[model samples]
Target: MVTRDSAWPGGVPCWVDLGVDDLDRARAFYGELLGWEAPPGSPETGGYSICLKNGRAVAGIGPKQGPPDVPPAWTTYLSVADADETARKISAAGGKLLVEPGDVMDAGRLAIAADPGGAVFGIWQSRAHTGIGLANEPGALCWNENMSRDYEANLAFYRSVFGYDYDDMSANGFRYSVFKVDGNPAGGIGELGADFPADIPPHWMAYFAVADTDAAVAKVTELGGGVLRTPWDTPYGRMAILGDSQGAVFAVIAMPAGG
Candidate 1:
């Protein structure tokens, strides 16, 4: 398990948050499923709730801030040394900024951007909030991955902006790679082939570690969430995709022994 008291290194995926219409329902659904304790959002921060696990910050749940048609979804935030500089790089690398770099009440400076492949993510330059406090443990964020329809363009975009090196793991008909920072695996990028539904746009997916994948799947269904994929074992672990009652998608995984 990984724990941190300070900001994550630049280029690492440091946090994941969900923006939904029903803050209370989202809080309850995740609190029950992942053993999180989320206090009511305060007006000062525009009703943003920071979900905690074992008394440490794990993720955030907040009211949706975009257009009315945009669906509720989880967003992955990558740590950076300078949010403004990263925003510049994003534009230079064929990305579009949805939100310009700005401070969020001194918690951090942030910018929301979409890669050429249309995968949206956040760039964070932390201040008081240093991102997730715990990870790779049950109920904590274990992984984040970007699935891209235009793989090559997105790959170039990230490499240029974040200096990420990839450890390709493609085999058979699959095209996948792990993005690394200083030789350590940070996240993943996978090519969304023709088999993927055309309507599903490129997006980053966040994975939460669980003690038992099947149990987590059952709990999700019992909590009024729907399973998008059944639990399946891989060399890494058993995992499944799920959608919350608000239609926010995320994944849960039971990591292999000593993994």
Candidate 2:
């Protein structure tokens, strides 16, 4: 399992959080569904509950800020050495800053941006909080992927901003590439196939690891969540796409034993 006590390398997907209308309900739902514990955070921390798995921080759940129109969804955050500098590079790379770089108390600085393909993601400059404490294991994040209609444009934007190297891994009929940071896989970029539904927007999707994808999906439905896609086997793992009761979609994968 991948565990860390220090800040992640810049350009790596370091964290993910869910912005929801009801924090209590979200905490309870995820706790039951994923075996997470999300006690109320201290007032000084803006009551941002850190989702814990076996007593280790895995993700976050917090109140949704901004206008009421802001949708409840899971946001993937990339690590950066300097949020302000990254913000400038993002705009220069043809991306728009949805939320300009700003300090999150003293924990870190962060900014949200949209790529040329219109997929929204965040950049985090860690200070007090170094993001996920455990990963690549059941009940924690394992992968993040950008599903885009314009893969080339999105890839170019990220490469320009994060200086990422990619390895083309397209096979069969799927077009996919693995984004690497210092020779280690950090994330993925996938082209939305023509068979993809028109209603689905381009976005960053977070995947959590599980021991049993089929069982996890069943528990999701049992807890009032919906199944976006049924369990299917991939070359990498058995996986399923699911949505919380609030309609925020995410994926869960049961990686082949050693993965």
lDDT of 2 by residue, 123-221 (tens): 999999999999999999999999989889988999999999999998878888999999999999988878899989999999999999999999999
Show pairs that collide, candidate 1: none
- Give the top-scoring candidate (TM-score): 1
Candidate 2 overall Cα lDDT vs. reference? Answer: 0.92
Q: Backbone clashes in each candidate structure, one number apiece?
A: 0, 0
Q: Which lDDT tens digits does candidate 1 get at residues 1-259?
A: 8899999988999999999999999999999999999998789877899999999999999989889989999999999999999999999999999999999987999999999989999999999999999999999999999998888888888999999999999988888999999999999999989777887779999999999999999999999999988999999999999999899999999998785
**lDDT by candidate, in order shown:** 0.94, 0.92
Instruction: Candidate 2: give the clashing pairs.
Output: none
Best by lDDT: 1
- Candidate 2 residue 141 C-alpha distance from true site, Å: 0.2
Please state the error at residue 84 of candidate 1 in Å: 0.5
